[model samples]
Target: MKTQPATTQIGWLGIVLLLFLAACAAPPNSPTPSPVVPTQAPSPTPSPLPSPTPVARSLRLWVGEDAAALPAIQAVITNFTQASGTPITVIPKPPDALRLSVAGLSLSGEAPPDLIWADQEILAGLLADGYLQPVRASGDALPGLQTAATSQSQLWGIPITAQNQLLLLYNRSRISSPPTSSDDLITSSRAAQGGLVMVWDEPYWLVPWLYGFGGSLTAGADGPPSLNTPAMLAALNLFGELAVAAPAEVKTYRGGQRWFGEGEVGLMVDGEWALSEYRSLTETLDLGIAPLPRIPATNQAALPLISGSFLMFARDLSRDDLKPAEELAHYLEQPTTQIELALALGRLPASMEALADPRLQADPGRAAAANQARQAPGLPPTKAARCALFGIDVWLPSLLKGNLDQAETAEAMQAEAEACVTQ
Candidate 1:
């Protein structure tokens, strides 16, 4: 070990310190360093949460209901709203005005109804004009409701009520017993002229008489109607005679019910739908429901037109929106709803289960209506059936007002029906 000088050792130490500092410092030509951005592991990208389900929209329904029946209908609707937690607005409309109401729907400053109350004739016409949409309801409808509920392969409406029988309604306070035959009715009506009232303005009212006289609206399902036949002439003349004996004021179904209630009219002809109203309108006046009088001259009972009332979708209702409307219709067709309507409003439920309920089976009023239903002729639904009805309605007013005779009216009706059918 040789002895070293202190200066030499100090220099060596300084050189070692310089090398250590140089190793820590950046090279002169190197790029400037960025601030240390604490390398994040991308925060483990948060998984996306699912979107919530959208709520169903509220629905709107247009009901062609008699005024007195609206409360019962509303009650049924209320139950559905509570169960589904959705709101519904029901609009009451006249049966005759329903078509025109939809015609001006765009101009009415409101959305078209999601559901509409439809019958055989109205349903047929609406389907033809593209005013209705094919619906998702079909099952166990009354026999005559086939055409009204479906269009060949498509379901169009849900049947709620059936057995739309023409009833001979009499105010028992004025007339003790219902006449058994047309001869008896004519005699009674003539003896007390202006005591009877019938909604003769409606063509459906004439259907029973036309059939009773052995006249058909058309030879086949499609027309060229057989309006100018001898049978039609006979039916028309007899209807006219009854009209002559009827009060001019009590011509509408509502009017007849009111007049009968007031004891101003002794007898009236209407449908089973009016039973509840007639019963409600008077406590003093005993309401009687009976089958239409048999035509003595024809030796046949008046053949009533039995049908089912339905819930139909409007054309503007999207297929996507149909589920809610369909649900509402399903609710309406349920046995609970159907039975409630039958019990409250005298409607004959389309549901067989509802129809078989002990309440309905034991109801005397409904029993009489059922008897009339049994007598209804099996009139098929046809494309031209609505047209034929339109023709009659167009020309019947003229015939009743003496603006046209039976022959002229029948010929005019035939022409009108043929034109509509051809179109």
Candidate 2:
């Protein structure tokens, strides 16, 4: 009866709304709802890019093709590269091209090297030609070496190592001990298998004999050649005597090297450049090295030319470029580097500090070289003197062959020297 008393009519919209509200409510017996998770914003990922490579600073170096020098120079360059993160391109140039390369007088149409290796002989020419720039080396450079690098009261380059005077290399198996005088040398050579061998005709070799006789190429550094002087005549006479005693195969420098290397010569006259080659040959042959014998007549030791290699800079280098180049040159001249070079090359060190090293003092060959340097004088490397050397090359054969008289040979040499100076 109560159920039949309902009076209000529900609308269709109200009925649908009541059903939606019932669906939204959770049932009392249902398990607890999971905690509502907050919507999270996603983090974006970045794409990768490549890193750029850095370009290394670089310099060009032209070094002589000397077998002994290359390794030492390359070692120094490698060290410098690693320390400074700079790259250096090393060009092995012919020794003959050293002067031309440094002077920017290239004949092969190649670009001039930024840094060049030159000997003191060519350094003089380079300085006179104005091809070399002044060095900014610390003033603690070796006095003698610094002098070699100087011209017109300015230092032009850094000295590396020095080639001592012409050395007397003999086969110890053939000669028990070194000869003290020219007479002793002649006696020992006469009994030996190959006998004395040298490039006696060349002025470079002739200088030692001339020096032994108290003769010089010139009276002054820039003076005319004194080829016709009495000292010259005496030197010529002594050289002639030695030539008569020596084997005919001792004609050319290369020939002498071959003869000595082959163990065919008993006494050989050579420079520091030949030390390594000689050492190689001595593995099979007994070799000995000593200073050149004294001239019996004059009672003077043979004083050959002492020269050094230099690091020369190009005149066209910009201030920025020049600073690094100079630093490299100075680095090479450092005591540690110089000592290493001297030990490797068997050469006299140009650095005084290197000279005082214990390693150098213990070396017998270097000891002889040091003694020879004390008696030796530097050879003038002027173009005129070089020209005179050419003339001597021409006339020397005739003089040695007995085709020209000694007096005539001297006169011809003097005339050629004068012509070269005047030109």
The model with the greatest lDDT is 1
Estimate the lDDT of model 1: 0.76
Best by TM-score: 2
lDDT of each: 0.76, 0.74
What's the true lDDT of residue 220 in model 2?
Answer: 51
Report the CA-based lDDT of candidate 2 relative to the real structure: 0.74
Query: Over the stretch 1-423, how does candidate 1's per-residue lDDT look in tens digits?
Result: 998999999999999999999998887896789888776665577889989978767677888877887899889889998998767888898888887787887799767788887566677767777888777654455555554455556777787777667788777777778898987787777665227787787888888899899887877543356788888888889888888667766656777767777778778787776666667776656777777888988888887787877788888887777677777887887887888887887668876556667888687567666655544653444566767888998999998888999899889998998888778
How does candidate 1 fare on TM-score?
0.65
Question: For model 2, what is the alpha-carbon lDDT of residue 320?
Answer: 70
**CA-only RMSD, every prediction:** 8.1, 10.6
Candidate 2: Cα lDDT at 366: 81
